[model samples]
Target: MATTKKYTAILLLLVILGCQKQDTVDNFPIMGNLPMGEYQVGFQTLFTYDLTKNAIPYSDWDGNLYQSPTSENGRQYQINIWYPAQPDSGTRLKYADYINLMGRQTNFGESEEQKTFARQTFITQTRNLKNIRDTENKEELNTEQLNQLLDLDIFARLDAQPAEGQYPVVIYPNGSSPAYQSITCEFLASHGYVTVAFAPKGRFSSGMEISTTGLEVAVDDLEFVLGKVSEKSNADMNQVSILANAISSSVGAAAVSRNEKFKAFISLEGGFISAFEQRLLNGSSFYKPENIQTPILFIYSPHPSIDPKYTSHLKYADRYYAHFPKISEFAMLNYGMFDEFIPDIIGAHSGNTKKGFETANELILRFLNQTIKGESGELFDDSFMSSRNQIDTTFVLPSLPKPPNMAVLKDTFWKEGFDAIETIYQQLKSEGNPQPFSMNFYTEYRDWLAWKKDEDYVYRSRLYDLAYDSYPKSARINYYAGYFSMKREMNEKAKRFYRQALSLCESDEDLSASEKSTLRTYASEDLNSLLK
Candidate 1:
């Protein structure tokens, strides 16, 4: 992303180095599982050394970093399985062990220095927050904070056998970056499900394989793993699910949309973007969504890599539902709060904080229990859409009304306002008569200009005018215009905008719960100020 040639060159070199992976097996963590669930967790690493039968030919895959082109042993993947351990199971494991296993199990092992830095960095931050400043308590606090961060009891036993005849299964896949294994694996296992994930370190490539033939390879690898899962004595094959993180959301969404194999697909910050959304920059389409009938639930937060001022995660879910109409559940997690939950960790994919982590697990548990297990009433009901009767806005995305097609703009101004900008862009791109729509819109709007929806409104009155006309019904936009107008001393105009925003918010279905709450709160304040 750097503009300088030297830095850009260096980044490119790092990309190749990043691809080098360790041939060693995965060393899964042994922490006492996360505590929200009833059963204590017991975890073990697994490997399916081969998948030759009914397998895609070795020659078919473009790259095989692990083996020869025509490997006799077929593709192998290391799996991490967490399950209910018996109350009398072995002593709880140490967090240091968890960190060490993770260090070596990665595609390439981290340098001893890199691993040490990570450990010390985490410990120091934890020590400060917990106020464990006493020098002597270093050892004690290290252990305590580690467990606190992960919600595990290193000394506890796993409830190996569930009261039910067999434990249901959950297959979790990492995102494109394949950075960290989600703590959800342990949380689910602790609650009586046989939760499985590809190892935090070793078996990451399959999950990373979505470029061209990567998706097919991932599916093949998954099929092989699931087939082998039937061999796990404690696992129940009848009820199974898949949870995907970020970019992997595409894979899960695609799979669920195409078939009936998975009972539920839980997306953490990613969805079927490939199906309807196109990245205008490179003119690339990632993956197409399937129109299958499987139930799917989404939990979305802004991508850590994106600047929040520019992007609102509120629309990602809307885009997906707009394309595939059948999706039953969607949540737009508030941005700033999620960042607070995982201050030390970055990215929407981590999902590793006290509040952020728990909310995700609880919803997932309720959804799985209700939909797959045939239980009911555990989840919040119709009120999920009520802006007033919502849970702590910190944890829930506020919902607002959305009619199929309506806007705040008067019909007379709608067509003319947007066409003005379109004509400007047209001239700018015209070979014979190119002209600037002003230097700001020309240079600042690169790939972003391709999508009219992401354009700025507050500063660019034309954009705001165009947007209000284009999506006059959007509570978020109306609220922005009101706030912008109020700040700029357009008292009468601001008053109208504020009043309109308040009204539109009640009927604007596109605004997520958080968006609606934000608009309503600000508009009320401005409207109050105007009257005074």
Candidate 2:
């Protein structure tokens, strides 16, 4: 009887599990999608690149770029793929390879020394975070939070079909995390380029655990993969390029410099000269910048917090830009004021240069269209250049509306005040930071520091009303009002604010999926609840 009961319970559990509905794999999320775009995909083979030439490059087994051809009998290599398939519709594609780290084979039962060296990769160390709770007592991602390990590729786009000759390929070396490879690969594939993502052999998924011949392997694998991609006939092999982010930028620059076939190079948040300097700081980069000859472009962050070493005299971009005048374009992104990443003092001191952080696709499009497509037009105009500069100066600057005087404040003090109190009517505009109080110390008196006076009762009803009145064109302020109304349990008011925010806002990249989903869900739930 006891055995029968246990069997019965196990049977029930199996039935329940079998009956549960799973998430529809076919309806996977395609991230970084712009509203106005066109794409129709189909299923195809996952063409993998080969990298056997870079097996052993570093002789001393220390953490450094290995020269594959000389040190190794030939070269060590690996492969990356761009499969033609629907996003989130099925199982992810996985490949197999041998990964060597610090002269240790990482396949299994590898040497203890190699294992220890592999563990020293910075990315793995940074991703180990202790859990912390938030104001809601819920787990909040803090500074030490493993943003890199947050399953970023959950609904990510995997690959895109490229036009038919071996296509010229471009590879991007990610910063800090191996996850960067996925992000860049997806972008390049979408733009009709074959992207060979590099990982240390045997370290395919674990990007940080670079093999003993990591750099040499990267170069050799890149060449091998380019050949394979070219074999497809649809690929253009002659115009291959390389892109690197942060630390990899240096490696990419050096590798491409030695290999003339690599026509162009791009550095996202990195520069060759300073790369060596930074390597020196971290006790690496044994080679000098002058050894590289690749033409490079750099994309930089505007926030001070993002680039803490801005105050340090290691301005790598400027220095390298001066040296490689013909082969480099040092364009920076510009962030508006009130951003929380970098503080004001450091941003100001660093001259707030290089501010544009365009979406991955947009950046790639601009780069490829300019270099490979060879088209020069008004797209890269001076206005765009100026905007990039403006963003750099104020990336972390908050958004705050300023009023003329108390009388004006009475009628309209805060920028989005009227919109906050009533229905959405017009689009909001913005010139600078929305949180004026955050601009500097003693900002608490900002309210009392009003410049204008209004007879209207702006301050009586709610904060949003006053904010809307003062900065009528500030969409962020309007969004805040909506956000606050939702918090106050004012569903109708919240809906109005959110709708106003959505209607008024022009860009979508800054808004996260959770935030946008919140507005839609709240609006629907509140409507249904009220009806019931």
Which has the greatest TM-score?
1
Question: On residues 14-114, what C-alpha lDDT tens digit does candidate 2 reach at each position?
Answer: 99978854323233222323221122221122223233433333322234553323223333333444423333344432110111222232222246654
At residue 363, give the lDDT of candidate 1: 67
**Candidate 2 wrong stretches, greater than 4 Å:** 1-30, 33-78, 83-166, 175-178, 200-221, 224-228, 275-294, 302-361, 378-390, 393-532
Residue 291 C-alpha lDDT in model 1: 29
Whole-model lDDT per candidate: 0.48, 0.40
Please give the range of 10 consecutive residues that has the lowest summed lDDT in model 1: 320-329
- Give per-model CA RMSD: 21.9, 26.9
Q: What is the C-alpha lDDT profile of model 1 across 1-532, one tens digit per residue?
A: 3469888898899998778432111222222122356665677656445644421221111334432222235454556677777654544454444444332222233467545644554444334422322344333234544544444223223233333447889887652111134356665766678877663112334324444344544555566667778798788888888877544555555555434577766765553333222132112222322222345565554333322222122321212111111111111121212234333322222333434444555567767777677886625555432321212322223222221111222232245555545554445345332222222222233223335643444334445554465456666667666665666677787888888889888778656688789878879988999889
As a TM-score, model 1 comes out at 0.46
Clashes of each: 24, 76
